[model samples]
Target: MKDIVEQNYSSSQYIVLIFCRLLIGWHLLYEGVVKLMNPNWSAKLYLMDSSGPFKSFFFWLAQDKIILPVVDLLNQWGLVFIGIGLMIGLFARLSAILGATILGLYYLSHPAIIGADYLLPNEGSYLLVNKNLIELASLLVIYLFPTSYKIGIDRLIFKKHE
Candidate 1:
């Protein structure tokens, strides 16, 4: 097996990266848990509110009786798995990628383009960038500059190989 190269990061950098990982993970986990606990919770309203180029696709996802349930289950479990994986530093890179993918879909569904409006009011003004985009970028950063192998559960698990 090819060896993994070690990269040195400053203490502050490590702290910030780890903090971002944990925070995003917690946020995803909370969202998944809330949806799971609420039996009536569905993505219909949100998907129906989509206003971007992919609006039609989102609407279809929310409207299709057969696919809707599958989508809901995947969203719920995907969030839970990705969140836990990130929080625990197990498959952190993969988790970040998946998290970013979900965020990307959300961004596409409700892009902050000119003249675009959403039923959900924006807490802050945005031109072409919003919280989802920002979080996606953060996840990308986490994926590129991974710390899991150094300080997360990955460290313990992968240590044997190293």
Candidate 2:
């Protein structure tokens, strides 16, 4: 009876983990595809012009004159890579970390961009903190649970290395 119960619990855990991975993966993949398809789908205008708390910060960044290009490239490539990684479950942990990091930066850049008002309750900007937090949590779960066992190429690669 104890063994059976333990087995059931383990199976349930895997199911939940896989579900989370799939959900996040699909979401990221969709975002990447959208951005890739839209050449003018730039966040620069929002980050730099939006009347939000981080507007000034983004403005400063834009005018930094040194890191603007690098930041722009990072933003563009980061989204695409993160989306691809999540979708394929390749180096999922690394992808998750990178995604979370990017999200975190966005959150810091404009905590009010989404709807976050805890710190400053106002219809200012979009508060991306929630999104970042959720992504970070999902990343942690992916890192700990490793849902690549079922449908990811990581399995074959890991086996080969072994």
Candidate 3:
């Protein structure tokens, strides 16, 4: 029997996935560009304000003068590259994984876990998980479903045997 997801999907499903990918990609791209445009911009504040379990590690990264710049550079470039990859449907799975990793870090930094209070301003209220977790979950969906075959470079590079 064919797998459930392997069954034919309506055009809407494909379009929705494409739109989701585009939306997330656009967000990542915009953020990266903004940071790149401003040399003084750094992830230091976010790192320093991190709460929950990884608080110490994140604080270390934020305060460590030597490592702070390196972290900042990687964070910016990772967002740019991952954004481009997702927008162009190039190495989408890899992009999704990378994006998830970035989001996971962000989520951990300002964890919305129940009963926890944070000094940082939040985009929205959440419990246990926030938009970051939601987006991360979306990336995981994209990774598993792989609509890249329908509208991505993966279609050409990873041709499936009939």
Q: What is the lDDT of residue 11 in candidate 2?
A: 68
Report the alpha-carbon TM-score of model 2 versus the true structure.
0.69
Q: lDDT tens string, model 2, 1-162?
A: 223212333667877876777777677667666766777765555466434566677777777767676676677677777767766777776777787787666666555444433432233343344555667678776765675644476556554332
lDDT of 1 by residue, 82-147 (tens): 999889999998999999999999899999999998986458889999999999999999998888
Which ten-residue region of model 3 has the weakest summed lDDT? 1-10
Error of 3 at 147 (Å): 1.3
| lDDT of each candidate versus the true structure | 0.88, 0.63, 0.84
Q: Is candidate 1 or candidate 2 better by lDDT?
A: 1
TM-score against truth, every candidate: 0.93, 0.69, 0.88
lDDT (Cα, tens digit) per residue for candidate 3, span 1-162 = 125225466899889988888888889988898999997899998887788888899999999999999999999999998898888888887998899999988888888977667777546788886888999999988777666667888668766678
Clashes by residue pair, model 2:
112-125, 112-126, 112-127, 113-125, 113-126, 113-127, 114-126, 114-127, 115-127
The candidate that achieves the highest lDDT relative to the unseen native structure: 1
Which parts of model 3 have CA positions greater than 4 angstroms off? 1-8, 160-162
The candidate that wins on TM-score is 1
